[model samples]
Target chain A: MVKNKIKTVACLLLTLFFLGGCKKTFNQPQSNPEAVFNELWGFMDKHYPMFAIKEIDWDKTYAQYKNRVKPGMVDAELFSLLNQLLFTLKDGHVTLMSATDTATYLGFYKNYPLNFNLANIKNNYLFNDFKKAGPVMYKIVSNVAYIYYASFAQNISDAELDIFFNDIKATKGLIIDVRNNTGGNPANAEKFFSRLINQKTLVKYEVIKNGPGRNDFFEPKPFYISPNGQTYAKPIILLTNRLCFSTCNDFALYISLLPNAQIMGNPTGGGAGLPYNYILANGWKLQYSATYTLSPKMRNIENGIQPNRTINFEPQDENNGKDIILETAFNTLSLE
Target chain B: MIKYYSNKTVFLKIGLSLVCWLAVVNNACAQTLNPDLYKWTFTLGLGLNSNSVIDKNFSQLPYSGNGLGLSGSITYQGRLIQQQLNLTYGMATLQNKYYNSLYATYFTANYSPLFCLNNASNSAFKILAGPQIAMQYARRNYSGFVNNNSSFEFSTSLATSIEISYSIIPIGLVLKNKIAVPVFSYMQQPAFGFATFFANSGSQNSVKNSSDFLVPNKFYRIINNFTIDKQLAPRHKILLSYNLDFYKINTIREVKSIHNNLIVAYSYLL
Candidate 1:
């Protein structure tokens, strides 16, 4: 009985020591809320290099927020306030953080976009003697059209895109290239795909599994037909490379399921989810994947979407502007 | 009677000191080392550049220029089943004399399965695989009578990198050699919508034609180092180390290569 008592005492003491050490490691000096607010306000007032905005009273804004902060306020509350202040600057470069929020922030880059090559005439218009380089543009006999969209973020207006689509619709067949697209807003992709897809069809399903401040399970969201209506009834070929990612990959995977579409080129860049952002203390923002996606065949698309017919691009061909991948797509369309 | 009381008080003080010492010793002994379990590690490092020149001849464009740089990193490591995993965060900033600056920040999570070479020595190797989030910021200002244009271009790039690291040492002075390959790099053109600015001035888009913000057609690094550590007294250790790093930035067409920097760093690891 005496020995047992000694063992229990030893265990209790060890636990206490471990807990104390952990507390010391994580404990930071309590920040004086008033001092922090004053410092932030002063930095903005004195060092704001740009005198762009003259209307708002910086001092009043600082005074209002300074008094609202309390000593016991959690890190989340501080982070949210910092984010609000940063957003006021309208600079996309600035961000804030706490240690706990970094994981989500790191995760945002993982599933952000699909990879594709982009070709914008306007981009060329800005430069004289501009030659179309990169894998996104191809000219095959001028009869078959090739277009590489590196991202959906291009400034192509809806009307301008419609006209471009109409121009391509006259070709024998169209090669929609999304070789290195990393992804952007799904709405942008929907605008392009809506013109090709005839009937309402399910493209991809998404489920948010885990993330900061997220629920345990979320139902899958589906990609549906766009209201803009269909444009192309002819056979369409999609050229993809390992760089194809995110929404671009999803569009290819979903459209491949259609009987009228065929996917060629390399396997896609693997990003099959959505990332949600959370503001943290220290004005750092965290983003993480709040979801996972599966193709219609119930296969996880994170490893990448495999092409129906695989065609590899030689590095030498890419340098010489000899687009072997586009040639394959053109031949496939012509054969059809 | 007074002397006896003082002695008693002294004895009590000695007893309390003994108790505290025993508690510390007991806790250390109870902390078992589980080889199968995960361990967290933090690292800090400083780097010096060997070569700093942005070779623009590969693209047939004007020189982008280069500058000296400093870098640092912190990492956490663990084992999940047969796989060894590491999560690292790193940053570097470089400044050229011509008022051009480059900043890079990245976070990478990697996993590699332990391939036991010889069971007798317990030394194993693995190929790391995972994703890296990288952001590069570049800004340049051209002033003085030497240059005609004076402007600043800022590019925000989001890229994913695939990395592979080999653990040459496992126990005391663990060394890992890693190489990262950027697969997808998407950058917002800093010159986007600036065409109107140039159009108004009839400058003919000179800024957009400059290859200052071209995609780093290729970027990779190699790190070789040994970490030696021994406890000097209690929780303190005299950490001494040497590290060699190599960085190569390739051209967009993979036709010609330029911009190579090698660094050797000596640091006291805490």
Candidate 2:
């Protein structure tokens, strides 16, 4: 009986282990004005990708914005303050999403001269009945295969590439128009780049944030594309505009690197950095760049990547059903 | 070397429950035991578990309150090992307010071969040790965040259970207290911020991080349930139980979870 009693005591002692380990936890942050501001500040200090190149003083920015925050203010009021802080990053990808709304910087394209009037091309060039080959919209223009790839969001299959290029294989050259593409998956850009290069090419490099420290980074890694056995040897002209962001910017930089390809039009609206999301206490999600990408020459293209030739259309030229940029690419492609 | 700190509040609550249990057992006297027994128990419980994040990856701050936890278990006792063998199948959930939750479905086989007396129905004390294997699925999703992700975990643990049971009447009432803890466990954690549920080599974007289903010394778990069963008929009984279950996993970050439940169930003894 005594031995049995000893066993009972042991079980109770073991049960005590559970009550001894509790600690404080937080799944959601409280709605404190100060806490929300601090979270935003901390998140940016740790996650923003382009601080090194943008040359903004984050500490000074924090001190300036911290003074504007106040208690009993609505989310919208606080969001305005955060928007101002984010705008200081000069990043086109940094964005704040609240319960009811979203705010981001379109500064790259906004207030800049517009390019690529699609309606003019549809009515005057492709004539509204351009063959819809898979996800690409294309037509033959003046003996050149004019293929307009609108967005990388649209998947491009190798079979579709074969069909499209095969149709234009007999033409003088190829005009690949990706004008207003705000970007999507970079893999699509790789797939499209693969068809142009006969050998592997290192187009860009990337470095993602590794730690909470503002300076933390993984050593930059090379991003490359391999040659597709079947290649397009004809002269390739890539069209661009200020509205080209993200993958569009990446694509323009890459396609222009090809020996046979040339980039024409205005500078690209650069968002070469990759964006990631974080959840706020109020269930709002704020997005900021977490990865930094570089051009082949190790140039920071966060603000904008320049084209080989900068050209603009005139009013008289457009009134005559001629886009000066497209005509230039057409003339260049036909001559080459 | 990494520094580790367990939650302070958790120690207080578990410590208090331990004191309360000690108080109750001390007041009760020993009773008779049955030498022959064969039975099956099915239990369902609902309770709240205050869970805090594990390790230094998360902020070490006080949590607001407890989250709702639920569990269901089935056990069978038969003459298999030394005196008795018990096999249990259980499923448990530990959820927090941040839209993060953990679910574990498990199978445990334990043999209580050594008793203060025998493996009979009327044994005063029993010590059981065996393996508890479980598949754990965890999810954390806050839509706007870029790194919000989910994972599926597989683990094996060596479980120890100390059980004390007493019968006050001929065969009418029985109170049982069991404290079970997995001394150490190894779990398979998915790669940080990567999903491998359907990972395969194809068009691209396939990095196989779910390579190992067994990793060493990556997990720990604990559960203690105290139950009182009162016989209603020859083969029927009413059971009331209170249980606490906790789980932790550490790789890049810690996945700490807790479950507590007060269970009332109808048990049929065969």
Across all models, the iRMS values in order are: 23.8, 6.2
Across A219-316, the per-residue lDDT of candidate 1 in tens digits comes to 44454554354367777788887666666767777668767778887777655555333222132333323345677666777656778888765666
Off by over 4 Å in 1: A1-142, A209-215, B1-270
lDDT of each: 0.43, 0.63
Per-residue lDDT value at A78 in model 1: 66
Q: What is the lDDT of residue B8 in candidate 1?
A: 77
- Chain A: TM-score in each model: 0.57, 0.92
Residue A149 accuracy (lDDT) in model 1:
72
Models 1 onward score TM values of 0.35, 0.71
In CAPRI terms, model 2 is classed as incorrect
* Candidate 1 Cα deviation (angstroms), residue B141: 34
Q: Which digits, one per residue and each the tens of the lDDT, describe model 2 over residues B80-119?
A: 3223333334444433344433344434343333223233
Q: Fraction of true contacts kept, per model?
A: 0.00, 0.18
Chain B TM-score (model 2 vs. true structure) = 0.58
Candidate 1's docking class is incorrect
